[model samples]
Target: MSAAALPAKPARTPTTPSARLAWLDALRGIGALAVVAEHLLPWFLPGLRPYWFNLGIYGILVFFLVSGYIIPTSLERHGDVRAFWISRFFRLYPLYLAVIVVMLALAWWVPVREAVPRDGSSVAAHATMLLDVVSVGGVADTMWTLSYEMVFYLLVTALFLTRGHERSGLLSMVFAAAAVVVGLVSSGAVLAGGWPAYVSCAVFVVALAGVVLGRFRTAAACVLGLMAVVLLLMSSRVPWLGVAVLAVMFAGTAIHRWERGTGRLWPVAVTTALVAISPLWAIESGWWWVQADVWITTIVLAGATFAGGMALRGRRLPRVLVWFGLISYSLYLVHHPLLKYFVQISGDLRRAEVPYQLGMAALAVALILGVSALSYRYVERPMQALGRRVSRRYRGGLQRGGDTGVAGQGAGDHGVLGHEEGQVPDRVRDHVAQVDPLR
Candidate 1:
């Protein structure tokens, strides 16, 4: 058989411009929107609520699944794990630090004491990406997931260092095994009365598994899904294990879809099931097993929705949603703190008044959007340009020395799967070339 006749293997492409992946972008926007709605519930909507913001929890799962799909692809593009980590640090840390600094300044200068609690534990946790690890409260409540992303990055880098990009199967197994070990260890610890350590370790393990195995071929997805189901059944008896299982399953399923390709009707079916049944299942089953089941369902459904939307016949996302996707990360990181500050300063405006709350919400959204745009333009873009320059220089140096794979020439552009569609442009490549002294 001709090579072209066989089923194509899944491979990470380098970053380049192509048609945008609207499904993933749309999913990100939806996740961010859900978060905004959940936060607004306390101030705006009352008595019409159902199930205590569980939808927000599901939104978080979508974020994780999307992360799993994208991060490894990013590592593969840069050709050097150390460089990838450096780039991630540049991209994530500046905004994070800026937010912290702003919050601290506001606390001291504005006479509002609310920013004080945002310091200490919350600040420490956010700084370290260990919010859940340290049990901090007021920092960025949504930052708990950033901790997971950090852990996943570390694990993927380790895998890349040891295995390069050749042995994806082996990498997937290692990831799965690590998760199992963590889950078992955490479960034992919980049974032994060290619940804090147990929860922390368990969370780390599950997230690790989610990122690693999530890139594996489709078969692993079934195994991960079944494991999640079993974990849900056992969660009432062992809550930590249950959560870990759900994470693993969600990652596995997302990876499977990413690898195998999404069919037209699949996402539609999955999203429908989740939107219609998940909440009701949670309501009926209560918090015990329901949390696990609902989360697992949410991830699967969100992934499907994204994939399906991307496969749509026409443009799947409006312009606004695509823009939101570009800046979603900044929005996610900045929104909570900004909202808290807004509420604190607007105390004289009658917090209970519907109009006041609505206005505050609108103002918060605008601030988040504006700040995110500015940050992307001034902060992230420059650093990304710098990283590309360094990478090209390093690659040129290797090429001059007659090194082949070191520069990852055969590797396509670094294609982070879930983000803006298409490969990195030639203009970016040439601009970086001009800046790269080594070249």
Candidate 2:
């Protein structure tokens, strides 16, 4: 959901982590616009859409890589499981729920996508943010990516708890291998129907509650990690793709490790190659984007983008790009639904004159950006403020010697997530600021 770099040395004071992180924001901004263009071009300028590579996939891959790079590091730095979950909830859910509510309201003007099942399980799946895996369509189309984001969070939490987090490179390769095996053997969802959604939802709620409440924490994390893997393999709409995506994320973590001097780059190289070809033998029909050539191109470009961002991590990126990154989550989640309604009201722009279509597209972008800025200002900021307060209070209680060491360090040693604006440590602030607008 966010991107970060590990500082080689800790600063005595919180210098300018933001400046160092501008490149990641640049990447987030570019990814957001790329995704917007992917949806917009088809509707208003079909002639501009490329056949060689998929813009939407490329943008999301960038996002997933960014998330992989930052999320686990953020968790490890925070060290407090409760505070980590609290921050995540505050950072992601408020805007996510608001978008879902708005989409449901917009359904009166534009019918909900037929991919969504008219069943209560859809509600359950949404609650868990496991919609894609459970084969329940999201209210908003882009919500599929959030399922993977949630899975990564759960897996990282478990790995951190058990001291297995350092094996990211190995984990990345394992998932990549799983993707290859799954692609060879499976064509579609094997654990089909609403039951997976319902059951997973129940398990997610129980495990998350236990973890956050600090009750049987290790057991809860293990259950969640195991459940995440099981769902990816058996319940996902495309099993190979799910594992492949996880491989991409962990590969991002591997890169972060390499940069930080704790790991090698070989696993990252292997992960990239495996993920690029994961869908080559996939038996699915009708998805032209996943054809061997196109899929390979998408992976290569995403990797290149991440590499570019990493290379520029110390430079000042364009302000416009950074601003777009600030509002990306809202833009990403709300734009598709807004576009649907825009089309419903304006009639099909695809059939309109080219100039008129272009004009309409410009207006749509303005509207989406305006709405996203408002959502960020009014929804995300205040919720994050509240999360900080709650985390501080909860953490205060745990500091009374209840906190124990893990992997030879105090679990609550690091302060992340809810640091008051200027008080944030330089090593951690860039990660927190990026969390300001999750992908």
Stretches of candidate 1 above 4 Å error? 1-16, 47-53, 109-128, 134-138, 164-301, 313-316, 348-356, 397-439
Q: What is the C-alpha lDDT of each candidate?
A: 0.45, 0.76
Model 2 lDDT per residue over 53-146, tens place? 8787888888888788777877776667887788888878888899888888867777777778888999999999898788787887778888
Best by lDDT: 2
Expressed as tens digits, the lDDT of each residue in 336-433 for candidate 1 is 66656665666433336777666766776787678878876776667666655655555545445433244443323533332321111010001111
Model 2, 74: alpha-carbon shift in Å?
A: 0.7
Which ranges of candidate 2 are over 4 A from the true structure?
A: 1-15, 404-439
